[model samples]
Target: MVPMPEQSPPSATHDVTNQPPPLAPYDASADAALLEGLRREGAGWAEDGVRLLGLRAGGTEAQEWGELANRHEPELRTHDRYGNRVDEVEFHPSWHHLMRTAVAEGLAGTPWAEDRPGAHVARTAGGLVWGHTEAGHGCPISMTYAAVPALRAQPDLAKVYEPLLTSREYEPGLRVPTEKRGLLAGMGMTEKQGGSDVRTNTTVATPTDEPGVYTLRGHKWFTSAPMCDVFLVLAQAPGGLSCFLVPRVLPDGTRNTFRIQRLKDKLGNRSNASSEPEFDRTVAWLVGPEGRGVKTIIEMVNCTRLDCVMSSATLMRKTLVEAGHHTRHRSAFGARLLDQPLMRNVLADLALESEAATTLTLRLAGAADRAVRGDEGERAFRRIATAVGKYWVTKRGPAFTAEALECLGGNG
Candidate 1:
């Protein structure tokens, strides 16, 4: 938590007209622009913040995502037991479209917008793209387009899930857009016992060889996104872990073989769904190769992690800016809070640090952009670099948020 600067008493000679009150009038425009922009380009999102901070634009996708995350606060009230929990929150389809536009628009001027048209698809009509999205990196959406090669490269979803994402649905199955309303119902991953450690998972998938031939037999505790059409499950195979593309819906309109065991009542992000589920001979399609389960799952996981970092980081930055404005305008005794020697110094201090964090994040993202374009050296160092960053920015964000909340006083 950021320590609040000392508040001084008002001075006697202070002219009421010279200084205005400190309470920040709610301004939606500023927060909205940054957030809406984040769904576009990362550094570009913080370019405005950098100018304000008097630093260069260097923040990462994580930082930009942090700012956007902050934008959700109005939507997130407190959860006494859960602490900063929100009852409900979701992205509107239009929100995705805006991000896509930002990508195209952003790329026209910047270098990181490789997936402009793809980004546009994500922004323009993402929700409908996939039902019960697995994770954040807009993977549920991006994969809708990205995994196409993997999807079509093999006979996998090419005849199945592919058409669902595009305007056409290959004759009989769920459509993408309507899939959004399909409420996942449940998921199938691991438990406290293990997550990525699929080897420790007790869930089992049996083979029947009846064309699509498959059956699930086991319990999946802590499947993260289980609120849609069904799930893409992973289970231990004789050779190793295997990923099965499982559907939540069945032919008779009956629930799929999967059943919800419980919903985790989380502390911070109550709006995001997390659950434990059971699968009883559930029908499914194997994704990628049979024994290559771990590899396939990583693809999905990577997508979510990226999106998560962006969203979390976006929230933090937005909160930081709002707090700064609040402090700058509020006054204690004679002068505005921002005019205080201590407050000004701290604000200056925060400006440099936060901007530095933002820039660093962006540079990493740019590096990531280059890397994805195939830049390689010592891969290990990149993660080491990421660790250096995640630690700094994530920490400072909350500190800034705490300061901002405190700055708002009882109003917060």
Candidate 2:
């Protein structure tokens, strides 16, 4: 009878999950550095956009979209059901929602959409806040924002696309630019052999009978945002390396020869698609004067480079917020993690760094706004701010991310 004592089941496990999941800050507008800097620097015009992004950044919808889009990476559909080479990449619905929200919030094209003082600063503030929700989709949004200044080098080219690019609506597809209410643009540089040395590109562009028109024949090693309506590509023309505007859909409702060979399986930025595209006699139009592609493309690159700085700064702020949130709820030894002395010191350091980054980024953005209005002092300061801020912030991102992740231990 003693041997008949009840035995417990073998497949039982303890319920022991700890450390709350770190969502975005409850209100990005309430960020001390962000609000203070905006007021001190006379960028109060951007407060409304920042507040809106703040309200959504920590919401359930943003959290779900941020998690799901990255979890479900984009699939490259090189062929259709009937075996036609469509070269389209299919995405989770979450990706589209993220893009639509970002576009409608003026995170991308606000500066170009409405030209005014504090325009770039306001847009930068909104972008920094929105970027905290998700970073991958920001790639296309940033590219579209940066593409404008470069396109302006050719007034004729800018005239056609500016309206679409600046539209608040978010239209995603391969439809004609004329038909779409909003548009996105991508950049194609860095061939397999060239990397950043675009001058070493071997892609050839032969002219058509029509002036300023050409057909490109070459391969792009890295093309960010393949789904974009149009891309600014660099190819060798009779006059040397030149910038050209290549559209996915040609003028006559026909798909161009821009073939997506394959999509890159990246370690990060899983929500966004980067690909190697083969341009087989791809029709394009010259962007700027021949052999001046570097000059024209540099304009675009500068804008993107500034975005890199701002994005890195936003990541730092995001890391601090997440770590701070986790520590406040997580317990260790005898008290809350944030209340402990050693943990407090570490977090204080991170907060200091984040604040510094926010100040510098917003200051630089303000400088850009002033530069456009012809301020020599701000223009000069911007050169130094951009170079130094980008170098310092990006270099610190990886290690900072590691430390912040450790704050939540296994929960991270």
Candidate 3:
């Protein structure tokens, strides 16, 4: 293994990166009104994320991790499915802090898997929302990110899974978990030829001699969360392409034949786990209707995209939060940064722009709620909203993050 570290000894420096995390039960009741009963079920974890976000450095394991996370946000030379090192990759220690907080607070039940968005859906939809997209804003969509339950049910694969998606790919059996907090991963997608042509994907699903057992064959360009145990794989059936629940390992927790050709790197979401996974006659189970695979996946993907928006919104929020904190205290050219005319103007813009992003994300989430519930509406109308929300939010995301980052400056 070229690079895989689990529970390594803390560095002797003042950096608080290697301390034990703060563990506590998450208070679902407090945020219930805000996130709509997201903590109703699942285990309760201590929610001390704000503390991490508000770090002044030097404190508990949680605090140190937060500071370390911000310091080490960039990727460490790793490849995507196409053998390209993901350069823009960075770490979100604050996010990790929250993940651990969730586990400690009893918000998550799984040992290593933490699905806040899933918990959000399960709680908000009263169990109606079975997929991802939760508390932060809306039903985020990305089949790879949304299909987390598949990971929760399996832990042995966690070692191989988490490492595979890091900014640096682990060599062989070297990947391992360092923090006992929330873990996140991702994959890629496209609708064009040689560009993730989902419709024309050569992948096929054929029934085996045994019933309910199917063999997967063909090349899939993107398989998000390939490192995780559960895979939301899409394959063409007799009708059209659909998703299959392919585990990283078999029922007994053994690595399967599914081959990961390479990991693909990208500009945005650099830290998110992704790859060009290839399943060659791999064994899997058909999740829903044979012909309805793409349709079913669209539902999952729709929710995940919404998730991307939520995450984007949060990133935007955090960027401003850090920026505001710095400008308010730091002085520039013998004057307080915030008092400067130009600085104030920029800060105001950050405020309005971020607020706009948050509002739009919420509205989009509302529309998604209706669509997912199958409420009264013309198909064309829902389709338009889905398309627009997906486009508008994702489109608006980068500018938001960029502006916020600029506002935060060196500290951010």
Alpha-carbon RMSD of each model: 11.6, 2.4, 12.4
Residues 112-179, model 3: lDDT tens digits: 13333333333222211111111221111233334443332234443444433221121212122232
User: Which candidate should be chosen as best, given TM-score against the real structure?
Assistant: 2
Tens digits of per-residue lDDT, candidate 2, 312-394, equal 88888887888998999888998999999999998998888888988888888888778878999998988778878888988
| Candidate 2: segments with Cα more than 4 A from true spot | 1-18, 21-25
**True-structure lDDT of candidate 1:** 0.46
Model 3, backbone clash pairs (residues 3+ apart or across chains), number: 47
Q: What is the lDDT of residue 393 in candidate 1?
A: 65
Off by over 4 Å in 1: 1-155, 162-188, 251-254, 364-392, 395-397
Worst 10 residues of 2 by lDDT: 16-25
Tell me the whole-model lDDT of each prediction, alpha carbons only: 0.46, 0.85, 0.46
Give TM-scores for every candidate, taking all chains together and pairing residue i with residue i. 0.60, 0.94, 0.60
Question: Candidate 1's residue-wise lDDT over 1-412, tens digit each?
Answer: 9999987677854656533343222232233333333344333433343233212111233234323433442122123365632222244333333223322222111222234322321221112111111113232333332233333323655565444433211112232323432122122557557875766877776777664456878887776545335356677665567777776665555446656555566665433445566777777777667777767765444333333333334545545565676776677888777788977776766555545554454444444443444448523444456556665666666677676667556766
Query: How do the candidates rank by TM-score, highest first?
Result: 2, 1, 3
Candidate 1 residue 172 Cα shift, in angstroms, is 18
TM-score, candidate 3, is 0.60
